[model samples]
Target: MSQSIIAKRYADALFQLGKERSKLDQFETELLTLREVYRDNNKIVSFLKHPRVSVDQKKKVMTDSFQSFSEEIVNTLKLLVERHREDIIADMIQHYIGMMNDAKGIADADVYSVRELSEAEKQRLSETFAPKVGKQSLNLTNIVDSSILGGIRLRVGNRIFDGSVSGKLRRIERELVSTNKR
Candidate 1:
């Protein structure tokens, strides 16, 4: 199976477990932390994936590194090591987070602007766009991209609402060119 499909399966199972246990937030947090740890430490991931390293040793390392995490989280890490699927940890965590966000009617958005958006601006954008996207609110991550020139571009999932000056100029140019050609 594709790695993403496998990861989604694991994420679904974990999500179901989280829901049943009423620990959705806790599980997502733990998994995100684990994902960050592996992401930031290439050596640890390489060590775990080494052919010579035993599963027990890898599990021990995981236990030591994540000792404070809940048993369910630790066991899931050990399970991934045992199955030689440790590489999917990050994907699984992402899918789990998506699931959590969907459950809460929240959408994660990337908003690109020429300058940093103030809290009030962000809140206004969230309120204005969230309803359009059928989401309760947007968890906005602001990115300053000077290329936008002015205005902002908002991306929620695969949809983009490009209100940037550069984007408008491009659209107008396209329209004018098409009309002239006709």
Candidate 2:
């Protein structure tokens, strides 16, 4: 009933279907693309989740939206709509991708920097972070965020190491206040 459970169920079903049909990679890609579409476009999401709209209408929109995508993904979206499982759309796709990566023995990495990191810097960071991950191989993604002020925030799976200037400032402020109180 919960979104998490629905996502897990849909992800498992999709993973099994993908594995059996030997199209897991394609399916994963399509799913990820569709998930991004949903994330970036608020209108499409509102249409699907709108209580007034019929499932058939939503399915049509989904099919039209993903016209260029693979039949597997389009059909899967249709099935999800038909089953009233739209809530799990994003989570299922993400979870399915994770499963596919695991199957290929690859790990996902995310590095957030205050500014665009140079290729050499990225490579060095990857080299430093990748080896620490228990995953066989790592796929590192760089994200630039000016709000960090300075430094990098490396996230490998669920673990996050915050090395940003904001984080440092907060730690320093905390220590300062604590010392002042003492």
- RMSD of each candidate relative to the true structure: 1.3, 3.7
TM-score of each: 0.94, 0.74
Task: Tell me the whole-model lDDT of each prediction, alpha carbons only.
Answer: 0.93, 0.84
The total of clashing pairs for model 1 equals 0
Model 2, residue 54: what's the lDDT? 93
The alpha-carbon deviation from the true structure for residue 159 of candidate 2, after best TM-score superposition, in angstroms, is 3.4
For model 1, state the Cα shift of residue 52 in Å.
Answer: 1.2
Give per-residue CA lDDT, model 2, range 101-145, as digits (tens).
888777788889977778788778866776677566667788989
Stretches off by above 4 angstroms in model 2 are 112-115, 141-153, 160-182
**How much is 32 displaced in model 2, in angstroms?**
2.2
Query: How many Å off is the CA of 70 in candidate 1?
Result: 1.3
